[model samples]
Target: DSMGDEHVWELLLPLPTTASTSMALSLLTFRLLLTSSSSSSSSEGYWSTDEFLPENRRRLRDRREKLERTLTESGIPYLPSDSGLFVWMDLREFLPPPPSPDESSSASSSAETESRESMERRERSLYLSLLNEHGLLFTPGLSMKNELPGFFRCVYSAASDGEFELGLERIGRCADAMRRSKEET
Candidate 1:
């Protein structure tokens, strides 16, 4: 009888074992939801270096410069990132276009057609090759404005003109290599 309406029953009857169990379960579920919500809300999603001590920041910056130099020597395009832990590479040109509705239907028919995993593999391979061949490495797939998983980020303390120049040189070399490869085939 008390179970018919929750609010009315609560007012009319003293708490029962079933009611207590239901209440406990609901509270537990609510608490879990709240905890997850708060955790996600607090995290801004991007890695920040402001929490580091000044000396540590300096070391990170120095290391970033050395890495940048190596990458430049090998020929990879990278821009000095202002967010302080990455160099941004524009990959808009390299990415394939969005499939049209007709194309999407055709793609769905072929299980081996382009896939997100395959795209990631290609990008990773290219990045690894650059690292191996030129000692230049980049954090691949990060956005300029937001942080996403598997995105490239650099850890550096300060930006310098010399670093910028070196980065450009490396990018030029990488671009040249890509062009040559395309021409050959």
Candidate 2:
């Protein structure tokens, strides 16, 4: 609050102490250690250059590419991200059309006679159907802050390599099943 826009004195915290400084330093050190060596104990493991460089970027890129391939092969659509622990897929095509953006518009009124309750039901059911039928747990895009509907986020790096592969397999199967069902309807 030193240069505060709100109440300067009211928002200010007490001046930092030596103890606080030491604690902050310790936390910083701990974070650096964790990020650099999450759980890889290969030979010559004394702060290798690969631990903090192009190697890590390359690996993340490879994983993303593999995930995109699996999604594509299963007839799922995705908007690929450059570098992240999670992948975002566009599941809109598999889902029924969303309620119109402008509720007051005549076009929206013509689109469906569904009430607000039905709209809520459809949104909730769509979220539940993917979870219950596919045995997958994803944070529905609409459920996340500022993340629009018609998307889902999957974190491939959260599990072991084998488990990640199995999860990908299940996702592919789910996508294929959804596509076939959509086509049949």
Candidate 3:
């Protein structure tokens, strides 16, 4: 499997040695493409500004709204995003507390305190907890190797309607359990 990285150029037929024949063939193909039109009513012409139909726009809007509502109800904080379909969820508040000083042998002055590294470690721990215990997969913000900690990227647009709703439901339950567990400690 190419995994969407298919080397398409290699699959193309070798260029003709005679330059004139190649030029004629390219011109003919271009002319045919320009002349052809889609008989399907849903199909849009090349360079059409209105690529998404009204029905498609409504469906996409409904999906995004549902996902946003689900996250809000679940008490998961997320950044405001309008340009893309992905949501950058902020989960810093739900991260587990750092280890107590009494439990550690080595006295790292600032190590015991909350720092970027510590925060990243906690993010990883939370990611693993979600994966193993909740059967939910989350892309750890720490794995991104960026400054943002406890920020997981979630894509709800690609999933089917039923799948997306179920995922949201599971996430809500998982978030509840995680918060409760964190509080008990």
Q: CA lDDT of each candidate?
A: 0.46, 0.59, 0.60
User: How badly does each model clash, as a count of residue pairs?
Assistant: 8, 0, 0
Stretch of 10 with least lDDT, candidate 3: 3-12
Q: Which candidate is the best by TM-score?
A: 3
Per-prediction TM-score to the true structure, in the order listed:
0.37, 0.60, 0.61
Q: Which structure is stronger by lDDT: 1 or 3?
A: 3
The deviation in Å at residue 131 for candidate 3 is: 1.7
Model 1 agreement with the true structure over 106-145: per-residue lDDT tens digits: 4453444555544465566656756675455555663223
Model 3 C-alpha lDDT per residue in residues 1-185, reported as the tens digit of each score: 12111122111111111222344664464344323422222143331214323433455567667777888999988886664445778887777766666644446635436556667778888888877888766667666565766788676545556767788888899889988887898
Best by lDDT: 3
Q: lDDT (0-100) at residue 132 of candidate 3?
A: 87
RMSD of each: 19.8, 13.9, 12.6
State candidate 2's TM-score. 0.60
